[model samples]
Target: MANESVTLRQIARKVGVSVGTVSRALAGENGVSDRRAHAIQDLAKQMGYRPQPLRRQRAGAIAVLVGTSESGHPDEDWSQRLIVLATRASAELSWHVHLEFVSRNDDSRRAVAVPTVVRENRVDGVLLAGDPHSSIIEYLHRHEIPMAMVGGRAEKTGCVCVNPDREQAVRTAIHRLFELGHRCFGVVLSDRRYPSTEAFYQNCRQSLADHGIELSPRQVLENLQPNLGGGVIAARRYLAAGEPLPTAMLFTNDWMALGAMMTLLEAGFRVPRDVSIIGQDNLPWCNQMEPALCSMDNREERMVREALVWLRRRIEGSPCEPHDVTVHSELVWRGSCGPAPRGSAPNGAGPNGAGVTSPAPAKSRQADPSSISLASPPGAS
Candidate 1:
């Protein structure tokens, strides 16, 4: 009997208990006395009665909370990608995935006012899909909830965060543009409050400084929305600024870049002809545009996978230090960017020598000018 087909029935027979009692004991379920459960579990272990994988215990479903816009709609492109990837990963792990949308503009104090899922205790953990307020994060910590952040850093709160290397991605963009002979540069950003947005701005400024170039205050266009309308507004501002526009402009994301591209075309400023442009988040539509958008590929799939892994570890009661996982981005060169416009100074030209005149002092630290590094792109002399 010990050598032949070890089963719960065999264990029950050996322990003088019913199969139900054996099952409950092996599963650590209540109803069986602690002493009896321990004895049955030990007997099953000794009798080589292995539990089937299909009956393995699970930590329950995870909740993915995404931030919605002012209109109460989540960013479809970003939110969808994260949900799909997380769902797929959860399926493989035999865990369920539940998605919840929260407003980006919600007051931090109000955001944690007992979400229905939390009150019902439906999920074992949470994956914050975007930059939620620190207050909400702190609330989760106080409740002893297992949580991980995606697409934003949460180092202060000791949450494991998975994000694209924004600084390095911006640096790569600058280097690529420099290689293409673009010295003078500009950027269009929205939502200064977002950590990701601030990172992009700071990194872009720092990268230019490292290349011996100055990012003038006028070069940055801010206070716009994150959508196409924002792009249109930014375009209007750029056109109104008059002559000597920076030869290369970087949009915070693809939507704005495409929107601005349409506006630029309508204004008779031929893209890559009058002013080259680059965007981030290499969205699918980028390639279909009149001129394919040159942007950074943020590797959304990898970002989600990393976030889920950390979340699963937390759910399993694994001990891990707070970690910041950075997935590097790739530069997707497209027709949107080209060599600097004619008469523009070459790549190594200083701010004064470039076609762009240095604007007034920057009000923010990101605008501070610094000396250029001797670093050259790979294979450059």
Candidate 2:
């Protein structure tokens, strides 16, 4: 067996930090960055060193996620936005933000390829931005790591969650559309399956049902990417079907919404008048459209703030609320929706499809915004 007489001096030397820093971190002081604090603490324990007063320091926020190539990561900006927010937030809290993108297949062959930060035991707690993968969840729980999931479900145990009220989002969107006299509805979803997307799809279909509207199987599109290109394909696919399109369409995200709008316009359709369309995330592009795209805001900004507050409480050994927290979504109404058209045209009936050309749109969604951001997700200082 290894000797158990390891000292703080040895631990500090091994961690490559000053003794005072180690003491402060191990004693649970607030100044050190959480990543460093967790790293130092883990090293000390590994060397059989014990901290005085048995305190644990946690002042770091790490963005643990499965990363795809940039092309596959359509939400890259979304992740970046969260980092910027976390950095700014942590600065206010005098904490540090850590980030590392774990490849999707990184741990496929290993039993549990824990993140470097977690394996090192650097943070007293971990804040999960969303549901990573099952492997990630299992690793955290098996290690008994304290974690708080924002915008995602908490795993089996030792975890808390801050989730978006997607049901409320659906309800709010449907109510708004109904009040605007839009009876026929359609939905476009991201081709891939994600917890958020699945939730949105289910809630939206259910909400429409609750409002006495029928969302036929064909009216829903879920075969394209979750980005602009996907939206473009969706519009084309709908046109090829030669079905009478709904008066209102809902996109899972703004990118897809913008794409569909552009395609529909090119095919001689008037937005809102021909088809009122809205999307989720309320991205910056919403304002750039000639008639801004209305959107359901996920309130990720508020969720991040709340998650940070919760993390601080947990790491600092302070009183914290229950294990679950919810951030309700809000719908930001804009020009993308209006009174339903008296007569709806089939996609194949548009000008590009051998039909009479539509009149010049009152407000074309063709003017490109110089800058646009698909807004979603945030957290803490």
Candidate 3:
């Protein structure tokens, strides 16, 4: 039997399981337990049960349609990461990722090209990677093209979306800062030029309020773009405003956080001493910084792979349930935050020999003021 060709039905019968279970186990379905699925796959391999290759359908290739031009937002690393992940995922699915890069310079070709690509059946489904404008999303919805968003939940349509729950991420960051004895809070937000981009900015406000951290209107600044330069400009303006500087200033993304660090160091502020800063999207560079960045890891690659799996299930016309998958982000702590000023911890954090043993609650903070400051004296590391 090991050398002989065997049908799936035979494998199912021999294994004493349903054909459907054997098929799903082969295809890696969600409901199939890993132990049973792996057993089925192993037994099938032992029996030399090779699946027959089905005819490739039009839905096999999923095109990833990006709304923004690479040139338009050069500093945003998230977009490039998403595209690379999507491409890799396509290869895993035995499908091609057709990138329909809509050039911003050619504004007129925008609406026409995407719909044309869909109608022509060039790909089985579409993955909208970047900030999709309302018009493009509307067109995708109108055409009934099987699609999903690689960003946040789609505002206009019910297309499948994969995103890190930003609200949870933001709340976690604030909770950590508060544990570290941070009272005043400041947030740098992305400008609301596109609809989907508003998710980060809006969620920050809600998270702060929920965490009991009240920030004045003047403390929150919105940069025109979501990039390094925007962060530098916003951080500079916030520091110069002369109002009591926030103990910690949270940024929208890692690139911005790096930029903010540069500005703060230039102004002679020691991190976690004079000001604690937190950023979202823990890109590779986050760890390379001198103090190392305290940021949230979005887990983009995993999210992309999961999104492809969902889109594939939908395209295959399988009884795949429609759902939103939100990946959780964990806080990556570093030298950026210091122990709160003396006597800040309400519960009196436990003491471990290496450092203070704070309960790794969903969020952690240090209450002592002597241990932390908002500004380090000039020329001090």
Candidate 4:
């Protein structure tokens, strides 16, 4: 008889255990005790028994759950990018990707509904692309569904997460600005509450403190949206405060940074001349702007790859320790940032020609925006 054709029932008969126990042991399921599972697996391997391939076990479909805003509108830019990356990665693994959008309102009573894929049992695993509500995550956990969170956190739900290293990104941005002769810094933040945003704020504060810098309350702008209109409001508020402006500013993302730049230019503040600014996401328009925006490039490809690997393991019934995976962010240098303005510093220079001490100049290079795909679906903003 062929060794690969050895049956689990034959192994169970030899091991004096039920066929179900032997099957769980060979499949790496948790029903069987560790001692019995190991013994059965060893005997099966000795007998040259081969478990069935994963492809034959079930349908090869994965679901991606995207969340809509409180107003029930989809965020095309972020969501589209996430979906594109996920689809690209899934293709390599021979898995189909399906997108499901969950819209929620302010009322907690009306929670986010379960995804249709889960209801229909069409997908083997799920990838959460955004902040789908806690209730949704809880439902998945209760049902014992294999799921991983991408670009978001689900620690409370015990779901593995793959996201950008926001703390490291903030530190890199601050260090780069410091080397460029910027001391005082301002930060623009969106009002939306998410784990990554919270991580950004905490890391920014810690990084500034590490440099013996104090982040003043006036320097932090919060509760603003993450759009062009929010950027306009932030600029107006900063200008009307009548307080001394920081030499460097960091916007949470590119859209708000572009909006703030436009508003500042209209008000006669020359970008990187009067003030240096940086943004995150390294979007396509970063290079098209008159003064190209310097931003952080969040490695979406790597994030997707890691998330898919974890999800694949879960779907294949492979034993994997749940852990968070974080992809580092790279600083994409462009034309937006420059040396701080003369005489704008509160303290005189320490023989460095400015208020802040400048370190030895490091080699800098401009990033090729063409290297990254910024294309979106038709009508996508």
Candidate 5:
């Protein structure tokens, strides 16, 4: 009988006990009587029973590090989704993830803080939420830690990068606005160190140039904050000038769009009525607002999911290719843009406030101070 296949119930019968008592005794995981545990272990050895592998019990953990300030409105939705997916995927492979938020208050301090986390093995891998934190990239590489970045480029080797094709995204937005007859363009953005901002301006310039339009530094407003207050600031100055306001405005993000909407309403301008507005990051606010914001659309869930898959593979010593992915954004046209106002000049119109009527190629007349060319294509005269 001992040499034959023996189930827990058979062992319980042999021991004159319940299956529960036999299981507790065989586990030998404490709280069991010495005599019962010894008997269960001896019986299990006789029955050729063995414990499960220890690796199956170990679920590894990864860490998520965010570069932005915590106090600031942490756009965790993007990172949160990534963590959730990673967490579930890890469960399949018997792994887990731990999230950590890192501050960029001082660039110098950022470098030191990252490697320390790696040396301590606090997180098996790291996921940078938004924009590339170059300092952390350098530190992690130095320690040979696996890491992934979403929404920005990664300079380090073996680092997986997932982000939207910003240039293409911006081009899509501008192209749609142009199709809607928006010749005068207004841009609201934060004057920050983010690469997305740089890409945005570059793409905006390239898109307009493709359409034979040129924008001056002044024509494109740069505010430190990409929030409502920033939009109000730009709009107030633009409106107070009493000059012809831009028929359309493109913000770096949705928060600024909210500000622009409020400012336009206060200044007696109806959205898509007097001026059209568009923004990036189709946040929830876009649909929640009364008129709803018109902006770029992104598959944030896809980005997060793919990033985690890549990170998991790299963590497990699997041969994973380092990839640079660019998710394209589609311009969702709502009630924001329309035909150019009657009598408005074409792409290369005069400056918004300079009060100088001019026409033709902007480059040829850019040197001439007397002729003010408003690169923003206004929809109205």
Candidate 6:
């Protein structure tokens, strides 16, 4: 009878909000607008509604972690970009921010630890840039720290994980490649430990299988180093392997694509004609490539901005349940991607002619930190 003495719907109706809003506001979670949240809260108390007591506290600072190599360099250029964007967003919102770099071994190593600010519960919440180690994720949850991740898929971490749709992006890329008549395929990848990267890789292979093209083991190059140099090596390995080159290649990110694309050109393999390429992250440098690399627009900036807003709302007490959100990405067609070479359907061959043996010109650049130019490219039907 006490529980039914007054209901959320009654409180919500009196304050002109959904019962959901009243629940969130009362529980001190994020979702409702500031003014409405306060009004709903005030009305609930006035209506003699008794809700469970909440012990949530706000420390006024947010911890932003960027997963990096033990040497301190980010795993991908996008990781570095996340730190810059997070810092700017915090500043613009006048939020106190704590920045930390974590070694890739964090999930397993005893030496790497969560930052002191987070350990002592000194921050309102934590914002992870890319994929931090699972141990780091565990520590946050153990402390009951509210969290929102920008890029990586931290599944079941009990936090808000948002990003461009990785599975859909792969499906979109395959659809476009299929439309252009591509069959046999190659790939450049990072370790599948990252949920986002894993999603993209698994779906790419599956999508191709749907069209009857089985991706070959020999053609898949796992990039140990996620930089341009790693990309270059992967491309070289693809060339040296006795396997015939496929007509299209896919990369987990733009960095791998840039290095591999340039290497292919130097090796006398014309892109799209000899081999087509598509990569993720829709980076600005994709436009500068000799043949403007084809890429998926992952909408990084929007994810970063939305994550901050999420943290702020949870800190200030808004009223909506946090759920994972996937934004759509449009495959931007460019010069680097073209139809399969005539007669190259199921797969193709090495170096076109016997006499071709030398290097060639290459090109690229990252976006400036001062700009937030990542917009969701329009989705194709």
The estimated TM-scores of all candidates read 0.73, 0.70, 0.67, 0.73, 0.68, 0.71
Screening candidate 2 with a backbone cut-off below 3 angstroms (N, C-alpha, C), the clashing residue pairs are 34-59, 34-60, 38-121, 38-122, 38-123, 39-122, 89-381, 304-379
Candidate 6 residue pairs in clash (backbone atoms < 3 Å):
31-320, 32-319, 272-275
Please give the distance, in angstroms, between residue 185's alpha carbon in candidate 3 and its true position after superposition: 1.0
Better of 1 and 6 by lDDT: 1
- Badly placed stretches (over 4 Å) of model 2 are 1-75, 104-112, 155-158, 318-322, 344-381
- Number of the candidate with higher lDDT, 3 or 5: 3
Stretch of 10 with least lDDT, candidate 2 = 350-359
lDDT of 4 at 375: 38
| Candidate 1, pairs of clashing residues | 212-372
Candidate 6, residues 1-381, lDDT tens digits: the string is 234367888998888778877866654445666567668767766776754223245566789987776625665688777888888888898778888887553444332456767765667888986566666776565344678887665456567777777677678778887777666677778876766667777887888777666666766777357777877888888777655566678887888877887777676667766678888788877776557788988887787888888877766767546578777777887878887766552332234321111212223423222221233445834
Worst 10 residues of 4 by lDDT: 354-363
- Give me the runs in candidate 4 sitting further than 4 Å from their true place: 1-57, 70-72, 104-110, 346-381
Q: Give candidate 5 misplaced runs (Cα > 4 Å).
A: 1-59, 70-95, 105-110, 115-117, 131-135, 156-158, 240-243, 320-323, 352-381
lDDT of 1: 0.71
For 1-381, candidate 4 gives per-residue lDDT tens digits of 237578878999999989977865654444677678778877876887764333436678888888777424566466778888899999999999878887532345333456656655678888886677665675566445688877666455477888788777788778777766677777888854766677777778788777767677777898787788777888778777766556788887888887787777666566777678888889877886667889988887888889888988888888766677899888887778887777555433333222332211112323333322233545867
lDDT of 2 at 13: 86
Candidate 4 or 2, higher lDDT:
4
What ranking of all candidate models by TM-score puts the best one first?
A: 4, 1, 6, 2, 5, 3
Tell me the whole-model lDDT of each prediction, alpha carbons only.
Answer: 0.71, 0.65, 0.65, 0.72, 0.63, 0.69
Task: Give candidate 3 misplaced runs (Cα > 4 Å).
Answer: 1-56, 69-75, 103-112, 193-203, 319-323, 340-381
- Candidate numbers, best lDDT first, in rank order: 4, 1, 6, 2, 3, 5
TM-score of 5: 0.68
Report the CA-based lDDT of candidate 5 relative to the real structure. 0.63
